[model samples]
Target chain A: MDERERSEMETRARLVAAYDAMSPSAEVTDRVLARLRDDARVPEKKRKSVEPDSRSALRFGLFLLPLAACVVAAAILLRPSAMMPTATKVSQEEVVVEETVDAASSDAAVAGDASVEVAEEAEGLAPQATKSEAAEADAAAGAESREPLCELYPIVVTPEGRELRVGDVYAGKFDDVRPEESVAFSEDGKRSVACELIERDGALFVRYGDSADWRFAS
Target chain B: MAIDLEAVFRRHFATVYRLCYSYLGSASDAEDAAQSVFLKLLNHPREFADSEHEKAWLIVCASNHCKDELKSARRTRVVSMGERLDASLGATDHLDETIDAVLKLPPKYKDCVYLYYYEGYKTAEVADMLGIPASTVRNRLRKARALLKDSLGGS
Candidate 1:
């Protein structure tokens, strides 16, 4: 053989020699086969007091319950803030109404004799007075409530024409909102409102016409 | 019904364990990896189409499992100068050094060398096993031979 052929032959011989040398010890295969045989035998089914089918079904249901709860928690956690109803706004409205009614009734009770004449003559006037007084009370309550709203100030109108409301306590993409803007909204194929920008606490806020509080333009 | 796992084990255990031993250089690890290969076979026996398919699957699975264990252990098989000289004495002793050198090569080249030399697989078989083109396997083998020749002093 030529030198090149000789070199090729030597290389092949070396590889073959190496392969033959490294063949696993007989004990390795014996151990593995032994383990395999040991693993193959099915364990005897114990005579269970419980029905196997029902037990398995119950176990499966138990397993799925946590998974379902996790899925629900994840859904609740990952759910869009826009889809969740704003409890803050609803609660704020309720508080405002409660305060106004309480103040009106207290004033009516304190004005005992005056309230009797007022109740008689103002039976006609009573309704108008109550309506005007309620309106005035609401305006005053709204102004007083403005301080807390301005202090934290959750809602913001973005430059992208989307209203960004705080969905949770912390400031992020997802936070709950209490609406500070009270613009007339059209409920068509889309519910939308437009409000101008107002600044409070070094942040740009949104203000609908005649609204007492300023919302953040997020 | 389950396939005859014992018959499969009896037939392929030696080849599978030898392939793992070549890769890992430890009888214990080879046994462990080989057992894992059979356990995998037991769990998913329907994967094989025929006897030839089963053999090829065992070799590939054994090789892959050994590599994964080696990676997890953060162990690289580095043959020392003394070890290399010791390996050159006998074909079987030198085999670990050859494999260690092969493993030191890049993954593509290492696999080609292992499949071609240790498993006695044809280049086409190696290509099919690795899911690469046959030409790629040939090129890798050529590069691996050149590398091994250089490392083993051009012998």
Candidate 2:
């Protein structure tokens, strides 16, 4: 054998002796056996093989129960024709005929009038805003346009006419305000955003969120 | 089937512990690993084709467990300085230096070197036990020798 082969053999011999020297104590063996003995005494249940069950289907149905209810409620609340008086209904027949006659002359104007009626019906606003309140709103909207663009806050309105909440993004115009920047509405502007529009005294204002107040431009 | 737990422990404990100690480079960790291996056998029994199969299984399991332990964040946080191999085996002064050098090897090579050199296993046998290709085991052994030669410095 060459010198390198002999040296390799010597190195192997030394490693073997060193590793063989390290052995576990008797206590470890005893402890392991004791653990096994203790475990053996404990009763173990028979393991069941996995199989598909109807319980999962039942659980899935139960999970969807609330979602299904929400969908149905949304359908009823969001039906477009439900907001208008039913023409065929016995109670609203006369009102519907009157509305039909009025709609024929100014169908476009009726939409704006319908908003006033809804606000009144919902008790969200005072009755017809009187004549003085209407003047104030017009003054507010007029004064808002004269103000510098920076003074005005972007109010994003959905095509559906509902005012969107703060931080909600929609790609469309709300009156004169165009979709260019993200909209963030606020009331007090200190804690959290409140409403999109606010009426204090006779003046109407749009909250730009975070202590920013501007006249209602739309 | 009732296999004698005590007999198995007595016969194989030293081999298992030595394999763990060589892999881990720490006496405490070796003992813990060896105990865990036996507990695994206790909890889950398997039919061994022969005594060779049983020994090979234990070695593979112990090596795999130590490798996993070394991978843990805790092991990395605490660097392992080599512990004194038990003196009861009556190792000479030269043997101690060799063992320390082996322990200092990178983990990738250390286990293979230990199984091949210390356990008196052929390269093929070590490969089979480690679930690795024989060519890979030979490569590790060769790399380990070069590292050991450099570390030992003309020893």
Best by DockQ: 2
lDDT of 1 by residue, B115-150 (tens): 786666898998898788999999998888888877
Residue-by-residue lDDT tens digits, candidate 1, A1-218: 89988876666767766656555556656766766666655332322222248757765787788999999878856767546565554455445455444554456668653443333332222221333443344443333332222233345444444664433111222222333432222112142333334333345455432223344533
Give candidate 1 regions above 4 Å deviation. A42-218, B1-3, B73-100
Looking at model 2, give its docking quality level: acceptable
Best by TM-score: 2
Error of 2 at B126 (Å): 1.8
Q: Clash totals for all models, in order?
A: 14, 3
Residue lDDT tens for model 2, A1-218: 99989998888877777776676667666775665556556543311111126645655777898999999878966877555553333233223323333343253246454434432322221322333342233232233222222333445555578676544444433454432233545333332232234333334355332222343524
Mind giving the per-residue lDDT tens digits that candidate 2 earns over B84-154?
Answer: 56545465667777777877888888778877887778999988888889999999998899888888886
TM-score for all models, in order of appearance: 0.46, 0.49
Supply candidate 2's per-residue lDDT for B17: 83
Q: Candidate 1: lDDT of A83?
A: 62
Clashing pairs in 2: A186-A209, A189-A210, A189-A211
